[model samples]
Target: MSGDRGAVELEGVTKRFGSMVAVDSVNLSVKPGEFLSLLGPSGCGKTTTLRMLAGFEQPDSGFIRISGEYVQGVPPYKRDVNTVFQHYALFPHMTVAENVAYGLRQKGVPKSEIAAKVAEALDMVQMSKLAERKPRQMSGGQQQRVAVARALVNRPSVLLLDEPLGALDRKLREEMQIELKLLQSRLGITFIFVTHDQEEAMSMSDRIAIMLDGHIEQLGEPETVYEHPSSAFVAGFIGRNNFWQGVATEHGIRADDGTEFVASRPEEDVPNGQPALAAVRPECINLSAERPADSNNVTAGVVAGVSHFGDVLQYVVSVKDRDLLVLTPRAHAARFQQDDNVFCHWSADDVYLFSARQADIVMTDGDEEIHDN
Candidate 1:
């Protein structure tokens, strides 16, 4: 823990249980002071990846390195890493400072040094005020902060968290996200966070690695991964998406609902007459009160539902027999009711083009058949 407390590399790591593969061959590198999240649905191998990093499970193949040193035979206690789980796992009878000092005590550190380090760690998480309080005396958020302090106190090279805030209420959970992010920056330590909450990963991560069926689907900055998803699975999993099945053509694509729209995708990838998938984010779609001037990627629809969020409005419009989600800003939210005819328009760039995978089942309204214009 006294050396450079960052830099991790995973080379073609794979883990299997019995005949089932829990983790496929995976490669990743985390830089110092970076906040990286392993995001996916449950049983997608994200938690397994975290366990491998923490030395809880040995990889069936490949190698792992920490701070430029190979740790193939290293154990959890020997490695400069610590984990904070969703359950705080605090000692119910121990005071905050005592709980934080337990790790040091087990290491047989001197009494004077343990007291000094414990005080310093509690201060870092802004919890020094409640150092003497028991776990039952503090709120959930505060207790979680103490857990964080315990992990940071060790000053590990890498900190691993597995859904650390899953138990908190909505408002408190959001507040903790901000606090944890700020703490990571202030300490400048690498944080490897694992979570299934898409919004949590999007808001807190510097880079997100999306996993599906034990494979890494996409890895990039949050905006890059969100705005330009590489595959249909990643697009549908990372955020809310509306999809339509179509056939690729040189001009564009012809949806099964008879809506012809222009799209930008590689020729080699989108072979002519091959099946394709079209995806657009809710925020990228625009809702207009009247008919739009142009015809490129523009169509008419009726507002099927309107949901009022605090600062934004979510509109579901039925276009070409498909329910499309659109986001309207609060300031521009006009009185629009269900069944009102409206225009849905978007730029060609906003539309994501991906090859139609096996899970290309489209939810439609049974309005019209696809047409190629």
Candidate 2:
């Protein structure tokens, strides 16, 4: 640690297991006190990358620096970093305070100092009231808070989290997300969080590195990644979109479904007449019973489903053997129903076009992780 609060850098980092390349040529930098996230599907090497940072696993190639200091072979304990895993590995027999104080005692800190730090850490996480309770006596969320306190008790420059909220239910997980983000902001600690959950990463991180098989596909802020995807895979994974297989044309692309799309914002350059793909987000689409006379971007479909999400209404419309997802604000009058004929339309500015190079890859919203390797 270079006396700086927090900073991390990876240069050409690559990790391999036998014949498999877990991570390939990864390069990233995190500012001091920044909250960064490694987000991707399982087997995309996010956990492996975090493990390398924690010193639990070593990289075959590249450099890693913590607070401007190269930590090639420094042990986990010696490095200026702490890890909080999904499972709260607290001692079942020890009280919360005891569990937090164990690290300080192992380092031979004075009993007086350990007591003060333990109290401070527990209070920081709002768990001071449960200091006397054992892990078995606490709720799942409470135990998780204790685990976080235990990690913070060490006061490491950087904190690495691996799906710390994975085991919690939806409501609890969301609540903890807000709490943990606030905690990191208050402490001004550099947090390197690893998660396969897109919404979690989008909600918490200052910047997100979206990974794919052995490599990073894109890196940007949440809004940037969501609004302007760099590739077809990114457009599909960052959120939901209606995709069209097509061939690039002079203005935009001609869809396989016979819908011609003209994107005012084509992110990728493709040769005219070449294979291509176009995508439009559900919120960008409008549904009407009357078909537009214009041919810019319009399609006829039958509403297959309607779902209310409090603030928004989502509809699945089937058109020409393919289903398109559309979202409308709840403030708008609900005008469509299941099996009703509808026309969907979007402006050219709302369309995004991508090269067909990534058309063959199947993107599944990061619901599965490749843990076998």
Top lDDT prediction, candidate number: 2
Off by over 4 Å in 1: 1-5, 265-268, 333-335, 358-373
Q: Model 2 over residues 1-373: C-alpha lDDT tens digits?
A: 4565588999999999999999999999899999999888778998899999999999999999998889999999998999999998999999999999999999999998999999999998999999999999988999999999999998998999999999999999999999999999999999999888889999999999999997989999999999888998888788877788889998898988787888888989878999888888899999988888777898899999999899989999999977888999989875788999999999999999998777766363666211100
Could you estimate the TM-score for every candidate? 0.92, 0.96
Candidate 2 overall lDDT versus native: 0.89
CA lDDT of every candidate: 0.84, 0.89
Reference-based TM-score, model 2: 0.96
Tens-place lDDT per residue, model 1, 93-163, is 99999999999999998999999999999998899999999999999999999999998888887899999
Model 2: residue 207 alpha-carbon error in angstroms: 0.7
Residue 371 C-alpha lDDT in model 1: 27
Top TM-score model: 2
Instruction: Report residue 13 deviation for candidate 1 (angstroms).
Output: 0.3
